[model samples]
Target: MESGNSIHQKPVFWQESMPELRPCHNRTVTAQRTYGGISAAERRAGRRAALLDAALEIIGTQGVDKLTVAGLCAQAGLNERYYYEQFTGRDAVLTALFDGIAEELASAIVQALQEVAGGSAADTPSAARENAANPSARRMRPETRTMAHAAVAAGIHVLTDDPRKAQVALAVSASTPELRSRTLQTIASFANLVAARGIDFYALSTPTPDPAIGFRATYLVGGLVQTLTSWLQGDIDMTREQLIDETTDVFVLLGEDLAQRLR
Candidate 1:
């Protein structure tokens, strides 16, 4: 079989593709305005944002199936009547929540890459002088390795930081194509930066079609998401730093020549 097609007749992200988020899944009732001195308009907006946040937290923790308007109200402590005031149904909330997650992940990736680049930058004048003196002693950018570590660290930090969202993003990957695509797209974008270092990333990202590189990429991305998620869930004993180090090592082993430039 194909690599992304299931090695041993196993499915990949099939259940998550169906956009299950809805108003009815939320069992919680939205509470009325609690703050003492807020305007009616302000209170309405606050309640709306709160409901959205509650929906994300719920979806991020429990699977999409649990993301009903009632559930959102319960989680946000808003009355059931307030749900329709902002959103039409669970799908609307899911769209908003998913969009939020994507933005968060993108920001995290950019930040991580920045950290790694910053960490890699070292000497200015003296390093140049040294490089001038020795031809083959090409000084690695101080930010290179730092970027590698930072990329891995940032992802882990985000996943482990929130127990509920962590599970939602991680375990849910095994069933939902939508979630999987959102995540893989993020991973692929990150990989692309590294992949751009070479003109032939398409060819070199894998060994042979006989070996199924597409599946390999999926496995790596999925494993990265799930592993960090598991760590956050307390299923794994390794530290975030340890996981970062180990994962970087794994990238090196699999990415062959491509992983080095990312470092």
Candidate 2:
């Protein structure tokens, strides 16, 4: 929960740990140029990915305070010169890493929603289909619990399967000013998305939209992020399945309440 300019300041523990570079030779030059017959750009991208992975590892275990350029390059098994090929500095790399995780989480949710929508469409009753244009007509629709379960499971699985990703996205991202800002922005984007989808699902029309809808969506997003962060940091003692079930239940109940209020 760190904030402000102080989060960007380097701590006393930020020490250089660059590994000694190997001596260059004609053989090494030739090998690097044609390594696996891949282009130089591809090789550089591979090295960048390796460095990001190393950064995630360090941030997760040793903390962001120890994430020096030298240590990152050394852990990535790349030369110091190569680090600059992709990122300007450690902060840039950290930003990119968080962005990548946010994209992954967003994609998982979208995919889950798409699957749920497809199933719901296929199972719709003929009468409901005919009355699609009747604003006053209510249909026997599929419960959103299935969608909630799918989305929650998809998001949680992405984190649990990769501890490094979980740590970087949920814990380390909140430890810096730049990263914390990015995380909050990402959360807001997700909150907006959820609110939009809720409106569409419930067909709730308001000449002056209820401010409570936005507030509720933001509250849900914040709660979910904090809960997942605690679980990832081992502050919560529930099993993965238990966590998914409980979270899905909360989301389903929230959706049901919203629907009732709209009605």
Candidate No. with top TM-score: 2
Question: What is the per-residue lDDT of model 1 for residues 1-263, given as tens digits with 9 covering 90 to 100?
Answer: 00012111222311111222335456644343446788555776677778877866776656677877677799999899888776766545554454444455556756756543453244444335434543322433433333444555666666566655555455445445665565566565544444442224224434333233444455566677667667666898976666776775555345554345433
* Displacement of the residue 79 alpha carbon in candidate 1, Å: 4.1
Off by over 4 Å in 2: 1-37, 120-142, 205-208
Candidate 1 local accuracy as lDDT?
Answer: 0.54
RMSD of each: 11.9, 10.1
Tens digits of lDDT, candidate 2, 96-187: 67766666777788787787677664344532432353222232233455556667788888777877777777554567787778778777
Every candidate's lDDT: 0.54, 0.69
Against the true structure, whose lDDT is highest? 2
**Any runs in candidate 1 off by more than 4 Å, and if so which?**
1-45, 59-66, 79-82, 118-143, 171-190, 193-219, 229-235, 252-256, 259-263
Clashing pairs in 2: none
